[model samples]
Target: MAISDVDLASLLCSKICHDLLSPVGAINNGLELLEGETDPVMRDRCMDLLADSARASADKLKYFRLAFGAAGGFGEEVDPAEARQLIETLIDDSGKITLGWALQNEALPKKAIKILLNLTLIAKEALVRGGSLDVGAEKGDLGIEVVVRAEGAKIALDDAIRSALDGTIASADLSARTAAAWMTRELAVENGGDLRISSPSATELLLGAIVTA
Candidate 1:
């Protein structure tokens, strides 16, 4: 099933907007509190909250621009460092999820980068109780291999998202939550590759992609 470009655009927009809502709402809330708070200590606290919310909002926007928008200049390949930075910024907010980034490649095809970003997004979401997130990419006989592993006290991956990542989602039933995963799966398929997810238990998750060069 081919998704029209316009529909794809809409889905990507929805995903970005949805992810941003919380941080953006926080910024709004902080502003509202600041407007009425006259106490010295509370004003300082509100400022701190505003700063954190603003930073989070900026980080999310940066992640989404690379993951869903036309970024990385005019190049067909993107720097691995850039992707690492984006993911790092995202994890910085949680202050609980530790990131172990091991990228051996200097760069990868943009489509592969997109797949990596989306997979990272999914893995990050699965770490419900904060965990270790290990993300790496390497080249092998199988092609460009992107692997992400998340282990925590609690992990929760939606079945719908898993289905979307594995190209098992019914096209008519796709929703905002599965949009990024579905897009990742399609990109891998187009590149002669596929996506896989393994969650042996509630405490662990592993996402992998093998995209042919």
Candidate 2:
């Protein structure tokens, strides 16, 4: 169930815009408030709000550029440190979620980098109640293995996303919410890789992908 390239591009753009709407809207609102505020203390508070909103907007753009666009410099491989920084920024405003990154100094191929970033995005969304996300990768005899684990008080995975990642959902049914998951699966398959999801426990969700070099 593959979609036309145009359709895929449109879907991704919609996803990014939707994710950014909140913080961007806040920035606009903050500007309006600042324009009307007269008290010194109130004006300072509005400025703080604007700063936070601007940071969040920038973070979202950085995360999306890696996950949905090309941003890792022109190369066959992307630096793992850059990926870590992108993920950290992505979760900065998503409550008290801690990240555990453990990847070798070696770089990952462009395809693997995309898969990793998309999986990281999905895992971050699953931890609505705020939790720990551990991302690790290693190149082995089998292939490049990427694992993203999420554990929190409430780990809720939407059924649509689960099916999409498992390659059971139809392309026509894919919405912006499940678009990234579908894209992740597609990338894995194109690279002789596979995506898997462990039967999440009461409070844990595991996403794994393997790409053969």
Candidate 3:
């Protein structure tokens, strides 16, 4: 099955909106609390929550603009250090997810970067019980290879998401799994790459992509 660019853009936009709702909702809740509270300490807590939520929302927008939006600045090639920094910022702002990076090359194609970022997000989602994620990218004679691994005591990946990544599910529903899978598939196709996944058991999951040079 073929996916149109319009469909891809819509999927990406839907994904961004879905991710932003949490922090934005928190900010709104904090505002509501402030309106109801008279205590100075409670007001202060609300202010803190508002600030945190605002910053997190801003960070995600900035990252998503470059990753998914129409920003012409990111050329065909991306700086590895910059990419790593962006990913780190996302992980830090999102909270509770640890990321480890191992890049053999200093740069990679833009499509590969986007795919890797989406994969990282998926891996983070799988670690609901809190786990570690390992990300690595290397350039080979064939092309670029990226790997994302999540290991935890309780890993629960939605079946819809798995189906999307496997290209067996459509994106009409646009759940977290479907959105991530759609984004990953779009990037892979744009760069002539392929996404592969392995779920050996309930507690472990692995995702990888390879793009032809």
TM of each candidate vs. truth: 0.93, 0.96, 0.87
Q: Rank the candidates by TM-score, best first.
A: 2, 1, 3
What lDDT tens digits, residue by residue, belong to model 1 across residues 32-131? 9999999999999999999988898888888888888878564489889889999998888889999998896577988778888989989998898899
Best by TM-score: 2
Per-model RMSD to reference: 1.6, 1.3, 2.4
lDDT of each: 0.87, 0.89, 0.79
Predict model 2's lDDT versus the native. 0.89
Q: State which candidate, 1 or 2, has the greater lDDT.
A: 2
Supply candidate 3's per-residue lDDT for 32. 97
Instruction: Name the TM-score of candidate 3.
Output: 0.87
lDDT for 115 (candidate 2): 91
For candidate 2, write residues 83-150 as lDDT tens digits: 99889888887658999988998988878888999998888888989999999999988899999999
Worst 10 residues of 1 by lDDT: 66-75
